[model samples]
Target: MKSLTFLLVFVPLLSVCRSQSETGVDEELGDEEHVELFTTATTKLAAATSDFGYNLYRALASQDASSNVLLAPLSVSTVLTQLSMGASETAERQLYRALRYHTLQDPQLHNTLRDLLTSTGTTGKGLSTAARVYLSRRLRVKPEFLRLVEQQFGTAPKQLMGGAKDLKDINDWVSQGTGGKVQRFLTKPFPRNTGVNTVSAAHFKGKWENGFSQSNSLESFQIDGGTTVRVPMMHQDNYPVKMGVDSDLSCTIAQIQMQDSVSIFVFLPNDVSANLTTLEESLTAEFVQDLSMTLLPAEVSLMLPVLSFSSTNELQPLLADLGLSDWLTSPGLEKITAQPVKLGTVNHKVVMEMVAEGNRYASSTSPPSHLALRVDKPFLFLVRDESSGALLLVGRMVNPKNLRI
Candidate 1:
């Protein structure tokens, strides 16, 4: 179980049309003062990294049950908790029970995952995540496990000066930690007693506090109740999202709103040949933070679908069939190098971009009234951090002509 190669690239820029008279009431009291600045240990590490990102997206969607899935489960759970700071106690108890975090305790689980990766790398928050640890320049690490993985993931550990400039310096540090949207993340090379290697990258490009209404009239989409496809749809009328339904996962949840606080929920699945396996086994993290606090705000009439795609996955036999077989068979990192190492080849990559721009303050001829919410077909999306609810990316989108361009 040492295969691990997960990659995802999605492009879906713009589309979120805000209006309820431009969200006033001091923006709902600034979202209740941004949920009182989160911190019951960063809300239990964002509900244990979103319940380990919905159990790693239901073990990678039960192995291709119709393809299309994405990941960044908080950058693969922060590179397995920074390689469990040089794991040992049976691979740090199988990486804290496969990252549900074994009921988080020790040092409040690395200071609440370094304050949830410094509030999801703040600065304009289009979302960003990075993790690294590549040794093997003739091993000999353990300087207190590189000072506890550079004091809880601020980065540190770069030795590998082997072949081809260590694959172009690990693909130029994953294209500058994904700001370049994950270019050439080691297309090939590095697999010959590769002592140790762990890299994680996540990049998101959704910035729509309000915008949408681009239509070249393609529509059609329903890839299920007897296949169809036309794509290129993004529109809005009243738009001011946050809707709900759920009848126990029958689906149809919305939530949209992106810009600094970041939130995109979308579930869909009413039944276009429904089979999202009970909405992907009814996701967790306290049921998606109580369905994002009981979604309500309305004024809909939206239609989405301009999504772009890219996915390349291996995921170490789906994380050793999800029980994490001793973290890929016998991983006692030996404090990251005592002439003995185990876990190797775990490269993860993700990139996203979503599209439709045009809300310089609404009035793009706002006419159509209430309830419409059309998202054509197969769906499931999540990309939160609504001030610390954290699950940074998780997707499904079944098909949009599988756009990899």
Candidate 2:
């Protein structure tokens, strides 16, 4: 199938830190030793986050199957894990259960997070992730918490004055963190007496391993059951990529390789009669792992619609819907501060693009026999960090014409 280039971004609200009293500093590992540590910790983290991501997506899809949806489960979990570090007993229980952290106990969770973020930001990679907590200047955050955050997350809490200028500064900080892909992340004014605001951001931009044909053309796109719109479709003939089918879900799975160490997997239903719910519910870290192991490479002609969109969701309601309800109350954050502290307007924003950029198309060769795959209808896709097998960005495209840029 044709190679697709996509840029995916996710912004999630959450905060966290390490603990000096609860846990001692972990010994540093050498390159070889760290690789093993990362592999173990990341695998456990991936399982928890993947379960949470699929669960969250299921909740979103239930409300509006025809609307475009995007999110970064890793982003949310990473920030929440940090929040859990300082959470009171009640709040910590809820957060840990929601993240499925109970399944695996990685003593070096904080150190592993540090390594993961550092590894993903190496030069030439198209992915980056960041998390930080903004505390009110009036509050006295624990010194132990501050030290751990600085040592583990690599960023210290910034004092928020709770003014328009401070909001502008936070937005600007997010924009710069994501390479200007996301701006105005916080549009609403900071609430009075806001004690803590957690923020997480992730961005990825990658080119196709085999560049798509630059000759883009207009084609019919099925936004939903009753709507049809024309959209720019990029095409490539005899593209080599891994392909598979999950008959139980009645969908075709294709893994498109990126120039960097990443892959985008698209799940397009076999036809209009196919069930999207079945496919979505079946997604898990283990399923993806199996697919990657079994996917066979083959030459195929592909047609995919271009998409650029952004979506924002209020995370409080969604988190509640997912059984993380206690965070909306006074006792939810007793451990965070002596003063009563409750969550306020936890928001998530996602920006994505599938434009062809800096592609170097190889000289055309004699055409070979190939299968044809055309994505003309609503579908679910995810951009994954190949090395860690973590889902960087997962989204559904219902209407290619509904451009949110």
Total backbone collisions for each predicted model: 11, 3
* TM-scores of all candidate predictions against the true structure: 0.34, 0.84
Model 2: per-residue Cα lDDT over 1-405, one tens digit each: 111122111123222222222234343332222222224787667666777877787787778876788886676677777777777777777887887777668777777666766665664557655566777778766767677667777677677876798879878887887788877888876678767767776666666777776535888876555668988887888776787665546677889887667788999986754557877877877677667665667667788877667776766567777787656564355445676666654556666766665357676676743477788898989887678777778888877885865
| Model 1: per-residue Cα lDDT over 1-405, one tens digit each | 011111111123222323232446556655423233234777777878888878878988887778778887888788778888787787787778878778766566787788778878876767676778787777777788888788767788777877888888888877787676777777776676778777787777777788875554688888875878888887878778777665546677888887887878888887888898677777776666666665667677788887655455546566775588766777778887777666667777777777765345377466676458889888988888777788888888878775763
Q: How close is candidate 1 to the true structure, as a TM-score?
A: 0.34
Q: Any idea what lDDT model 2 has?
A: 0.70
lDDT of 2 at 344: 56
262: Cα error in model 1, Å: 14
Q: Which structure among the candidates has the greatest TM-score?
A: 2
Error of 1 at 160 (Å): 0.2
